[model samples]
Target: MARWGWASFLLRRLTGTFVVVVLLSVGVFGLLYLAPGSIQQTLLGTRPATPETIAAIQARYHLNDPVAVQYLRWLGGAVSGDLGVSIRTGMPVSGMLGGRLSLTLALTGYGTLLAALVGIPLGIVGALRQGRTADRLVVTAGVVGLSAPPFAAGLLLLVVFTGDLGWFPGYGAGEGFADTLWHLTLPAVALAAGAVGLLIRFTRAALVRELDQDYVVFARARGLGAPLVLWYAMRNSLVPILTATGLIVTGMLVGTVLVEVTFALPGLGSLLVDSVTFKDVPVVQALALLLTLLIAAVNLLVDLGYSAVDPRVRLGGRTS
Candidate 1:
């Protein structure tokens, strides 16, 4: 691999980050505006507030200003790490998010790792053993995993493992690491299933395409072992797989919300859902923004990762 120059790479990554942040801010602002009711109702009570109280709340939240002004104010505050106070909890939004963010991150991060570990190998094996029994079995498993909804899987797992067998706690983060792992096992598998299957399919397809490429045939003609040639081919084939995985990872974060709700886990997903339901604007905004940032960061990393793996991708006009 060519040396990836730090200065140029950072510049490229920062540029992309800037663009994504602007788009995210715009999107969030639009969603807030499109929320049911006027800014007063969104930031204040539905009961007719005394004019003085309404004015005070508007001033407090910057709602009295023009949309542009309000956005700029929020943007400034956001840059300063102030997401404002949660209307529902009467606490700082950042503190509340910080409390729950780790749980969601743990669940999603570990589940994604498990998915990648299982899916990539399965895909490689299935592709190599195409038309054989092994391929059939792996493909069948992928199909089932892909087709099953996570919430349904969660429910079924709860019934079989927790309800029938009485083996594991159905919900809550347990007291210790071992207990936590036990509780997380079902939800993690439920969250990972669809993503794992998608990655497998993508990897298989990419591998198939890569094997047909002229370079792969040339490598084979040069007397490379099947495994060696396939490994090289897999690396080249992984661009699409990497891209697909990035998207699936982001999608899993969304799915985590549903999984959390179903399993009664107190992760950021559940917190966000609760905030939305309770009309806790600050919490809702903070959670949404945090998720957006996480997704954006992943996408940026994916771009950099692609440039690292493939010489064809450029960073700062340099073939890296």
Candidate 2:
């Protein structure tokens, strides 16, 4: 891989990421502006409010400003690391979000890890076995996993493990490291269910494709042992499998939101849902921007990883 090629690829990805973030910020602010609700009423929560009180609240948050002006104000504050206070709790949005960041990362990381552990081997076996009964079973399980949504999976896990079997707690992020891992077990599994299926299918398909390539044909014809030939196939299949992995990991953000809500975890996903329901625009916008950044960062990493995995992208002077 050439140094100049890597520089150009990185520069392009950074440019794209910046554009996406800018668009997301504008879209988020605009949608909230058009969102039907009274922030004053939401803040007061059924309390009686005089005309004077309402006017004061509006002025305090500069709600009277033009929508574009308001967006610019918010954007400025966001750039300075002050995302403003939550309308619902009057707490700094950054601080509030920071407290819950670990659990969200943990959920996402654990889910991805679990998906890789379960999916990769099954996918390889399926590809190797091809049309056998084992392959059929693996394919069938993948289909079923893909068909089930995270929320439904969470509920079912809760009922069987937490409700009936009493194997795990139903909700709450546990206190310490061990407890938290235990608590997050079900949520992670629920979040990863669909990803597992996706990985299984993607990995199987990638391996199958690699195994049929000319390289594999030559390797076998050269009298390479079965293990050595399969190793060649596995090594070549990494790029596609990595592509699937990147997608699964990013897609887990959405799944994390659903699973968090279903499991009642105090993470960004539940916070987002609650904030939106209560018309907490600051929290919602902050979360939206943060999530967008996270996704963009993951995509950038995946792009870099592709070059590393198969230096052809860099050496060939092509950005894929």
Candidate 3:
């Protein structure tokens, strides 16, 4: 593959990503616009929706404009890094998102790391032991993990660790790195449970296929130890695992909504929920766009990782 080819491939992907973000923004904006109930109603609370109050509110937020015009204005502002102020709090959307985004990112990042660390080894062990009792146990555990909801898992953990054992705090993002880690431990585990199950299944399946390949059999026949042969096979099987990992990370970001709500953590998930409940259009729109961009960026990195891990996987159209 030529350098120009690789460049073209990356350029194409970047263009596609931009298109996806645009479409996502349009969809989010449309959905919020079409949702029932007027912003005036949300602002008035229990008060009567008088004609004067409705007109005043509509003019104040430019809600009297056509939906398309409003969307275009918001999109233009987003491009310029001005996401507007929250209707509910009068705070800048960007400023409100900053601290919450950091907390959500931290929770998801640690959860992804923990999932990979625990899942890969479990997968290897299950693959090596095929049909044994250990493999059966792992399979069962994976099934349960996949079937259980994150919030339910979180509640169970809270009951066990915080309720019964009194081991870890049940809520709040604690101060400092160490304290935060302590506080996040249960939430991370709950958030990661489903992802760990998915990784274990994907890794086990990939390894099993790799181990049956000619190269793996040849290496084993040459008197290489089981560990060495498995290592070689694992390298070849990484593409699928990497794909699964990217998806898991994306899911973690989405799943943080439920996990954060369950744990009562001060993260973007909680903020998003509150924003929606209060009909804070600016805050909701900003968070939705940010999450979409984050997912797209992760997927872009995963595509680049393919070429890095396997020389045969040319980012260009032609493979060597």
Give candidate 2 misplaced runs (Cα > 4 Å): 37-51, 64-66, 315-320
lDDT of 2 by residue, 210-293 (tens): 988998889889899999998878877888888988898888887788789998999999999999888787788899888888
What lDDT score goes with residue 74 in model 2? 84
Q: 88-133, model 1: which lDDT tens digit per residue?
A: 7788888888888888888888788878999999998888888899
Query: What is the alpha-carbon lDDT for the whole of candidate 2?
Result: 0.86
All candidates: TM-score: 0.91, 0.92, 0.92
Error of 3 at 303 (Å): 1.5
Q: TM-score of model 2 relative to the true fold?
A: 0.92
Which scores higher on TM-score, 1 or 2?
2
Off by over 4 Å in 1: 1-10, 46-48, 315-320
Alpha-carbon lDDT, every model:
0.82, 0.86, 0.86
Model 1, 44: alpha-carbon shift in Å? 2.6
Candidate 1 global Cα RMSD: 2.5
Model 1: per-residue Cα lDDT at residue 310 = 75
